[model samples]
Target: MSSSDLAAVVVTVCVVVALVALIAVLTQAFALMREFRRKLEDFDSKVGPALSQLADTAEMAQAEIGRLRDLLNIAQKVAGLAESAGAATARVAATPVDKVRSAISVLRGAQTGGTGQRGKAEEEGRETGSGGESTAAGSESRGR
Candidate 1:
């Protein structure tokens, strides 16, 4: 063959080889893009429901927290009422005890036939003489 025709043939073969390589690279890029699209679709299908469920769970948790807060408020009110009731009960109970003590002192004065001073003096005498014995024993020994 002529030198010019041989050079042309060589250039044409190189161009064809470069085109084939380019086509191969483009085909691989297209396949990679399709694979990436499929993976993105799969991720959306799986994660979409999970995100929705997470939102629902958060809402439920908030509701439960609100319920708990309400319960705590009710418990605080109940505790306050209980404390008030206990204080009232203590006052009511103490009044009766004080009244009974006063009545006993009055009865002791009547028994002594004077003010309650004689009764107290007599009790002190009994305590000093009886060596820690009960008041009932000392009264029995004294014959009332």
Candidate 2:
């Protein structure tokens, strides 16, 4: 055989081996891709419901947070009203009632003699009827 013919034979063998190697690599790649796709499908089937439930939970939490915020606003309004009521009560207590009671006392003292006014006032208070504890204290003070 000629050297050129031998060279040609060697080249043909090399090309056949390369084709085989390429076919093997392509087959392995196809099998790996198929396995990856199957695993992805399995993951989707298992985790899809849980992910949907998580989204629902998040929406519920958001709604609850809004309700809590509204509750907080109502609480703050109530607190402000309470503060205003306290201030109004303090203003009323600082003025009027004491002046009216003093005026009434003066009128009663004029009706009774000045010396007998204390006893007369105590008797009138008892007749009007007060709590049991104060009645006891009044009786004790009278004894003294």
CA error at residue 74 for candidate 2, angstroms:
0.9
Local accuracy by lDDT, each model: 0.86, 0.84
Candidate 2: 10-residue stretch with minimal lDDT: 111-120
lDDT of 2 by residue, 1-144 (tens): 999999999999999999999999999999999999999999999899999999999999999999999999999999999999999999899688888899889976664554365556566766777445555655665554
Clashing pairs in 1: none
TM-score quality measure for candidate 1: 0.59
Clashing pairs for model 2 are none
- Per-residue lDDT tens digits for candidate 1, residues 61-80, read 99999999999999999999
| Model 2: residues with Cα > 4 Å off, grouped in runs | 96-144
Error of 1 at 16 (Å): 5.9
| Per-model RMSD to reference | 7.8, 11.3
lDDT of 1: 0.86
